[model samples]
Target: MPVTDVTTDPEQLTMTLTAEFEASVDRLWQVFSDPRQLERFWGPPTWPATFTSFDARPGGHAEYHMTGPKGERSSGRWEFLSIEAPRRFEVIDSFMGDDGAPLEGFPSMRMTFEFEADGSRARLRNTTYFDSAEALEQVVAMGAVEGSTTAMNQLDRVLTGLREYAQGKGTRVEELSDTLVRITRLIDGPRDLVWQAHNDPELMRQWMLGPDGWTMTACEPSQTVGDSYRYAWAPLEGTEGESFGFEGEVLVVDPPRRVVTTERMAGTDGPSTINDSVFEEEDGATLVILHIEYPDRETRDMILATGMAEGMEASYARLETVLAE
Candidate 1:
């Protein structure tokens, strides 16, 4: 187990757990900043977590549920209180009901995580403060210690696998659930430049073209929430493909960090998909992680069957060239 020690103070109504890892402090921080990585080890062995929404910033909130082997689910929410990149973060953690509200009679706690470099490795100090001793005791009795220990132990595999999983992979797709899919690509550029390439019409027109022999004919991008944007593409002369386009309304925008939008094919009344894209910088490269929620399983499968991942890879490869220029 990575947990080196676990201590509790009844008088202070607090519990603290210390753990060490063979990864750098920055690498350790990525696991928390990226929801995809956070879900990998946030729950115990038999109960795996799935984060439907994660916004890792002060005042932002995250919602997740851990599903047990028997299909039972335990939902939770986190209200980010403070954050200091590669160092520390704090959140108000609460049990959530199926209706997405805090569960009554459940005690919420203020949890803080601190990370630091310890010689060649990294160390994490996680502390949880309860409202009272009773609250602390209640969680302990609910197997909090054991569950947390097992969860942290699973982090080793995740930390070790991240680099090999994404470093050179052009564009990777993962089916997070029946309706949700995640696509990630590490672009060789800074976060701000990558964000500009996505939002700036001229820059977008340069690289958003999915495959060779295709041109972006129209690029109307939405810059504000509630506003709609449209993009159209056409095959170059003699190329075999039909012209098509997509339209979407922007729901949320945090410049150079995250954006949420609802997308659907233009000129069609098909069900729309919610797309949440996040940008994070690691070692000077920006990683683009997109979570796409389709209306149903059929829609998700149909989109994937259309060779979406392959097309995205081609676009991303072109994006790198644009960035280099």
Candidate 2:
């Protein structure tokens, strides 16, 4: 992770975060200056930020909202106070309501972001000054530390090109928290084709099989929000394992880009997980990121212990072959 330290001081009424990156100071500055790039890692994986409006100059302000898995949104705005190219910038950050006004009863904070060169690397120091200790404590109690850490750690991937960062990495899984896991893989195909492969039954049957001995017996994919999908697999005649399946309801579908669903074991009363899958295309290839939020820590552990990552990797490898064909 890029984030190194996070500290809060009651006496000073401030919180500070320090992170180091392998990129140069100029590169680090560009990421913050560009709203598109900034939104990519400004929020945690579960709630990704979308910048509705961004003006980077001093005296300018930016409006953005982070959307949660269940389609809930939390809006925020930043008023740029000062800007020093490739070095530092300052802003006043405030919570906003749906009417585009700063929300009442919410404390606004002054934030300063400083970038410095560190001999072929860069260091970022972000300090937020609050009006009172109560305000500082409030944000901390709201999981600010963990949220900021996870948000900053994502900068590493944003800083690198998609292909350079994900290609050849195969299917990688990261346990973000007790109940959240992230799975990522690079598909050697366009985003549209990759999306089609997931939604088309004929295409899915070609590669969605977890292991060589298993065959997809049924695939009913959801095409719209509120629709339910079911997939079942059974071992080949000579194979050993019994039949199993999964069912899920589509919650959100932004074709070729993102899809959110609630997934559970087909016939069981097991807890369901919210799966948010995002696809981004770069250089004729697609990067697939799946963020799964389990119902509990035990559920997360049990699912991961079933060699889920390895199974997904096998399926993804097969998808690459299918795409080539």
Best by TM-score: 2
lDDT of 1 by residue, 156-225 (tens): 7578764454778778887866987878898888899999999999999989999899999889998688
Estimate the overall C-alpha local distance difference test score of candidate 2: 0.91
TM-score of each: 0.61, 0.95
Model 2, span 188-248: residue lDDT tens: 9999999999999999999999978999999999878889999999999899899999998
**Candidate lDDT values, in order:** 0.86, 0.91
| RMSD, candidate 1, Å | 9.6
- Number of clashing residue pairs in every model? 0, 0
Q: Candidate 2 at residue 223, lDDT?
A: 70
Which pairs clash inside model 1?
Answer: none
Off by over 4 Å in 2: none
Residue 90 lDDT in model 2?
99
